[model samples]
Target: MLKIVVGGQINKKEIFDYIQNYYGTENVKLEIKNDLDAVMAMQSGQFDYYIGACNTGGGGALAMAIALLGVTKCKTISMPGKILPDEEIKKAVDDGIVAFGFTASHVEQVLPVLLDAIDHKN
Candidate 1:
């Protein structure tokens, strides 16, 4: 199972919907708030990765990654361009989870690059 926490926007259903399309709603989760809440949720050992959304894609994701570093082996994937298809984002999260071993700091640094790779299908 892959867990995703959503940031930005109140109605996070759209993001959830997108993610669910590929991974199924049961696999994807949503937390509609800032990075703090996202990190807290991750600390509970419920999710594998933290997925945050922002207009720029750095602020919320960075905040969550910083909080989870060294504590939770987790990573974050942000869609800055907002062009990522649902399946692509899902695959990015999955691949990140595999390659990074749930290290939050590593995830933070790799998320942008991961998204780019996903976008380009690299």
Candidate 2:
């Protein structure tokens, strides 16, 4: 199973529910965690991926992951009004970015593509 954690400043429950409902529990497992704990867990290999959201995408969403996991391991896929193209998101996964952040408002638009990319990666 692929283990992923919802580690963001906002919409943790909603994120968890979306993944659970869409992906089901058989192949993927998700947990809601605070950003710092989520980063620590990822460091310890507790999760295969880290996802977070904030207004800016890089602030509360990715600060800890970037600090602990290094900038190379993390990517901000979306900001307030800017979201990366789908190909770029896939490329980030191929490039081995284990952590992803995006604006909370973009979750509905971003999760499907992001989750599909991750699913393909696994």
Candidate 3:
């Protein structure tokens, strides 16, 4: 199973909708809470991966990563490119889950590539 955690009140909805559209409503779990909540959940071994969406994608990622870094196998990915195609982001989810680590200005740029990497890894 793959677990995806979205941070921020407004941003979480946007990312959650995207995940459901691509992965199907039943395939993914949604977390609409502060980054701490998501991170703690992941650390508890309840989730396999996390995807936080703050305005800059840095704050949320940082909070989750810092919390989950030692507790669970975790990674942080960014989309400095603003946003990418939904299909592309979907494909990257698996890889993002597997890689469990990333940080950059443009998260959109690496989302697709990260997905490919995760897919290949599996």
Query: What are the root-mean-square deviations of the candidates from the true structure over C-alphas?
Result: 8.4, 0.7, 5.6
TM-score per model over all chains: 0.49, 0.97, 0.59
Write down the lDDT of every candidate, Cα atoms only: 0.46, 0.92, 0.52
Backbone collision tally, model 2: 0
Across 20-110, the per-residue lDDT of candidate 3 in tens digits comes to: 6656677556555566776677667776656655545555455556555552344444445445444544554543432233333334465
Question: Which candidate tops lDDT?
Answer: 2
- Looking at model 1, the pairs that clash are 73-102, 74-102
TM-score of 3: 0.59
lDDT of 1 by residue, 1-122 (tens): 44556543232445445545645556445445465665676677655455554444445445555545542343334344334344554565455441121223333343455434433432
Query: How many clashes in each candidate?
Result: 2, 0, 15
* Candidate 2 global TM-score: 0.97
Q: Residues 26-53, candidate 2, lDDT per residue (tens digit)?
A: 8787899999999999999989999998
Q: How accurate is candidate 2 locally (lDDT)?
A: 0.92
What is the clash count of model 1? 2
